[model samples]
Target: MDAETNQSRQSALGDLALVVGTLVAVKQSVLPFTIVYAGPVSTFSAMIVATFLLYRRGLNWAALGLRKPDSWWRTLGLCVVVFLAFVGAAAGFGAIADIFFEDVGASGRFDFVKGNLPGYLLIMALVWTHGSFFEELLFRAFVITKASTVLGGGRGATLAAVLLAAVFFGYRHYYYQGMHGALVTGGIGLVFGLIYIWFGKRNIWPLVLVHGLVNSISQTQRFLGA
Candidate 1:
């Protein structure tokens, strides 16, 4: 490569490094306060920040897969099919694990519904809106996009980004769900990461919907006292 091309690539990477560093600092400093004081609105702050960063970087919503697809119905249908498949797979794994571990995850996951309408509705709303929205944008879009820049885009880079981000995604859940839930969440994150990569990392709507649906179904189970 020519010096000019190499120089340009380095300059771009430097800019990305700066942006990512600032975001890390901001998250470290601000997230705890938001978690304590903002409740569900913690993610609202993240959404706002992500939007501003995207704008400043001259990135459109297309960066996060907000484009017109060939068929919207096809996208939605695919999401539904993927969601069901994941649930079925998870159930099978849980059953097999149960044989040896005997209720391996019984105490690790969240009970979202709480046996009440208002509380259940609130939890569902948060999962569908903030949790799915901010999480997809944060992890699949921003984190993966920025980190993948270092390795450059290729099959190897995509795989590396997916594995790295998926592990961190599982770590994100470790506090609330413990080890068993963290591992399960990490597996889910790997699938979502692959979906993001498959779509050229330009669209994560399907992943968002799948995540929201999983949380919704879990809440429904809890509501039914299962």
Candidate 2:
């Protein structure tokens, strides 16, 4: 490649690095002060900044799988598929978990989220918005894609990228959920990664739906004391 093109690519990557670093810093800073202390605003805000930066650098929405799909209905159908896959996987893993690990720290999340109806209602909204939108943008769109390229693009790269994202996803939950919860959440992250692969990295609508639904359902179940 020519020096000019190479220079442009390097500059863009440097911006991406800055974006990711800023995101981590922002998320870490806001957690102690907010009700949604997990910092969805920070995550979402960083993404907005990153999107603008990437755009200025000539990166399009497609690079983040944000393009409009050919058929919204088809994407909805894919949502159903991924959601069912997630539900089934969660149940299966839970059953297996019941056998070996008696206390998996799953109840800790429930205790934290459960509250009076008003508080619970607020939590439901936060869970869906944060889990579905911001987390997906950060983890699947930017992290997984960049990880794949950084690991050296190929089949091996894809596998490594998916697992890399999954591990980090689970690790994010580790503080709240402990080892068992982290492992299960990691498995769900793996499922999301698979869905991302199936979507051909061209559309992430289904992922957003599936991810939102998962958190919404989980919150509902917890609210119902189930």
Candidate 3:
């Protein structure tokens, strides 16, 4: 292989390794289910390692395109639009499905009777924060960028990365939320992948915030229901 091709291969391999490492860490952590779900330190560590690999491999942070406009208002507006657009779309689709399927997620929606509100809120808050940061770091910043670097700009690589990450993201939920959760989370990953590509690897913080906001809303709803 030529020098450029070899570098691309190495970058792609690094991303794959990062994803695998994160999955393995999630599987092997000794922390209690609640604790691990709440904090997600294993994922945090895995992403840190991924970032190091990217840096060592001379991956460009600028290429990741995380920088935002200088105006706080503009940034906040963009974030709000992105978050609402995605969440609204998901809700609309879910509502439509409810018409035919009898509230598919209603059973798992919120169980306030079984758990106290305070504890649930605390756990959800932690998870929302930790989960968003770790997920974006691993999937968007590392996985998508690495894949793009290797596969070049085209539909094939983008679709491949989205599908692969969606699988992993779905499986990650299976341990906690079961089959439906896996499906929903996988869809979420797919959306994030599209957004990552749309943004040209820059400004992933919006995605991170949007993700956290959605999780926070779900958690709040659950808490209130409880």
Candidate 4:
């Protein structure tokens, strides 16, 4: 590789190391504050810190996969594909789980829906978008980028980074959603991770939309069932 390529690789690796250390430490340190503080504040703080580090290192939005789309039509097509892929995968996995485990039935989600469809919709939109976009931004974009850079860019490194983020992502949801949620979210994380890598980490608008759609569908079904 040329001197410039070598330099870029080194820089990416350094960024990756900084990112991993920050995430690990921030997650652990912030837990103690949950009694007095809660919700997305901790994540928001971590995001701000990560952004500061990137800016200090002279990293721009493009470098962080924040590129603009070429055309609206193209963007729409990409959105459809991502939506189908995400929903289809989620359904397939959920079905498989249902078949193997009788106890793992789809019950609780609909309870919320049946009781209050409108309320569920509103809550889901807020939670999913906030959960999906920010989580994606942090894990898929920021964390994956750092890991990929540090380990070098290739299939192995990419998959490794995805797995690493998925573990943490899965853990984050485990408390609220239980083991089932953990599995589903982890699976979602893996798919989203691949999509980000495949698209070279461009604007994540479509992913956010898909996430909202998926959550809406899931919530609506529950409400209707109830």
- lDDT tens digits, residues 1-226, model 1? 6676566456546644554455455555665664322323544665666667678768855766866667778888878766865676566545544454433343423344557788677777888876677777766776666556655666787688788778877766554456665666677777777778777255567777787877787778877788
Give the lowest summed-lDDT range of ten residues in model 1.
34-43
Cα-based lDDT for every prediction: 0.65, 0.73, 0.65, 0.67
Q: How many residue pairs in model 4 have overlapping backbones?
A: 4
**C-alpha RMSD by candidate, in order:** 4.3, 3.3, 3.9, 4.6
Tell me the tens digit of each residue's lDDT in model 3 across 45-142. Answer: 67667767767768644557656645657667768877866776576545544454332353442454235767676657665656677777776667
Clashes of each: 0, 0, 7, 4
What are the models' TM-scores?
0.75, 0.80, 0.75, 0.72
Worst 10 residues of 2 by lDDT: 101-110
**Using alpha carbons, what is the TM-score of model 3?**
0.75
**RMSD of candidate 1 to the true fold?**
4.3
For candidate 4, lDDT tens digit of each residue in 92-153? 65666555444333434235446676767655755564555666677778888777665677
Q: Candidate 4 lDDT (Cα, whole model)?
A: 0.67
Best by lDDT: 2
The C-alpha stretches of model 1 lying farther than 4 A from their native spots are: 1-42, 88-112, 200-202
lDDT per residue, candidate 2, 166-199, as tens digits?
Answer: 8888777665577777777888888888778768
Clashes (candidate 3): 7
**Winner by TM-score between candidate 4 and candidate 2:** 2
Cα miss at 65, model 2 (Å)?
Answer: 2.0
Greater-TM-score candidate between 1 and 3: 3
Ranking by TM-score: 2, 3, 1, 4
Better of 1 and 2 by lDDT: 2
Task: Please tell me which model should have the higher lDDT, number 3 or number 4.
Answer: 4
